[model samples]
Target: MDDNKNLFKQIQALYRGLFAFVVAFALIGVGLIAYMNNPQLFTSDITASETEYVPIPEDDSDKIEDGVHVRTGFVEADGLMETVNNCTNCHSSELVLQNRMSKENWIATIRWMQETQNLWDLGGNEEIIVAYLVKNYPVIKKGRRGALTDIEWYDL
Candidate 1:
């Protein structure tokens, strides 16, 4: 009975401590919010903090317009006009952008599209489109990171 009482008292003490810690964290969060809203209330006589106020940049120059997104870079190439003429009639530029293939692979893909997706024959324009795809969208060797070593496996 005495041992059980002691264990219960320990658990009660632990819960009280946890509750106190949570209340302290909440109060600190509320205080920080209030201070941010009205700095004058919290800065009566305290020295300046080490943190400096760095204003966020307010410029649109950072926004780059790839031809795919902004119609600027897409139609600039010689053979790309043929690609756009035939390609966009069926699917989006996003589909083309996602794929990276060689000239032979591009031709194979076109043949597959004709066979399955009911794409029309490009005739002489197929060569132009293939050249453009090979030149612009060759296979990008994305060296992905391998699985993480020394992982600390845990159970819930």
Candidate 2:
């Protein structure tokens, strides 16, 4: 009984000691924070490197909060609400945004997802989603800039 009491007493002493140390460190941290002027911290000009400065080009993409660009769940469009309600269940909105397809292609892609990727039949919502996707993300004409013209080659 006496031995058990002694062990508990020792444990209690150790716990008290640890508590005091933790409290001391916390108090010191608080004191340091209280002693400092917050304005100086923000106003100080500090830079690790000043070799090169290249500004990012502005994009029309919407930012949730100005000054910081955070990717949003959905882009602003006519059928945005319908698209969000139907899509974004299996994949991210970013994925949808990245892909561009025609109306027919979008329909085919949705069918493929339903058949293989375990996507449920979107039913009436499918048309709305397809319209939204086609309107926002149309197939780009990816080819040469101008019409082809036959040019005569002369030996150098």
In model 2, the worst 10-residue window by lDDT is 63-72
Candidate 2 runs further than 4 Å off: 1-73, 146-156
In model 1, pairs of residues that clash are 67-73
How does residue 10 of candidate 2 score in lDDT? 100
* Candidate 1 error regions (>4 Å): 1-69, 72-75, 142-156
Give the per-residue lDDT of model 1 (tens digit) for 46-97.
Answer: 4556567889987742233554424323534568678877887777877887
TM-scores for every candidate against the unseen true structure: 0.45, 0.45
C-alpha-based local distance difference test score of model 2? 0.76
